[model samples]
Target: MGQGEPGDLTGRAFPLGDWGRPAERLDELYRWVERGALETAAWYLADRTGKRRGARVLRGGAAAGAVAGAALPLLDMTGVVGGVAPWGYLALLLGVACVAADRYFGVTSGWMRDVATAQAVQRRLQVLQFDWASESVREVLGPAEGTAGEAAERCLLVLRRFSEDVTELVRAETADWMVEFRTGSAPLGIQAGGVAGGRAAEGAVVPGRLGVPPGGTRPNMPRQRPPEAR
Candidate 1:
């Protein structure tokens, strides 16, 4: 990867570009899509695995806290455990905190969402491979029955369409995630709604958040309609 190459953004499903000839560029475009999709799947799979473990830990912590909180006071009331009853309320509070943290951090839901998105992208990758194959077999060659330029044009068009689809797949997932974070229903990232309206609209990226200066993360491109599936 040279300076300003698209592959520089590791683990990102973003587009790629190269300074090669048209044939080389076309080959590279396909490779980039394949690589990006595979990496996206791998990243999400790893992410979901970690989050699944976190979800289990949170559930266990909450359950243990609740059991201790209840049994400690019971044992004290029965005179089986002498002065330990006073700590029961603290245990109950710990349980409540655990539950709150689970929701706030989206341990379970995030893992589920990651799995879904990863599988979706993987399926799309298969579809793209077959779609390109379908396009390659068509008799759309130039008047010479198989001109190099016309064949390359067709291949480029097919690759471009597939690339756009990949981008849309990622963008849709991102939009869903942003909406969840901002909406009050998730009990997660509620401040995002307020922050987006108040701070972000003023062209100021929150410090230590996103780490990208205003307009540097991605071009503020218009919403694109899904490309026709060919």
Candidate 2:
């Protein structure tokens, strides 16, 4: 066997095969992953904001309607119905309108769908980032049963396929939303709610994960930077 430095592989910043093709291709892949992560983050923020606001509006409307309805009979019994009956009726109508807006007009549903899509994208990004950090390109792309050059080529091929898959997934998700927006069909919230109800009926409901995954670090991956560096 040829002699080489013992720490050569262990000391490198990345686990890619070499400094030539695999390194270059992996660098490009990392750039694309970083961009996708940024876009997903923005989408997630917008969806989360919309979801919270919509929920608040729905709850407020329900509370207002309840208070008004409860007071109507009391006002009538006290012989003061004439003064407040109209306002109570008006409040009830406003509450009904708000509920209809949330349910039928797709405000709440749209946000729900966006949030789900954003979360899916975020999960994919996390998987890719974790793989990049912990696994060598050869191991990720294949069984790592070949020479360095063959591994590099396999790595490139796998990255290409992964890139295409990610692109297609994102395109399909965005297109689905666009179609809903254009045609005014059921948004993701309503569909997911239906499925959830079905599952509950069948005793198959499962809770979702609520904890954050472990984080990773890489250059050019948007995170808090030191003030001097910024």
Off by over 4 Å in 1: 1-25, 136-154, 183-230
Per-residue CA lDDT of model 1 for 167-189, tens digit only, reads: 44444434445545555123221
> Compared with the true structure, what per-residue lDDT tens digits does model 2 show for residues 1-230?
00132321221132334556666766766665456444544544554675668768886997798688668756966997567777777778888877776665556655655565455546655666665655474465655466767755755654444444344333333444444556555434212111111111111101111101111111244788678954
lDDT of each: 0.56, 0.49
Best by TM-score: 1
TM-score of 1: 0.58
Shift in Å, residue 109, candidate 2 = 1.4
What is the total number of backbone clashes in candidate 1? 0
Pairs of colliding residues, candidate 1? none
Model 2: residues >4 Å from true position, as ranges?
Answer: 1-21, 77-82, 137-144, 161-165, 175-179, 182-185, 189-230
Task: Give residue 169's error in model 1 in angstroms.
Answer: 2.9
Q: What TM-score should be assigned to candidate 2?
A: 0.57
lDDT top scorer: 1
| TM-score of every model versus the real structure | 0.58, 0.57
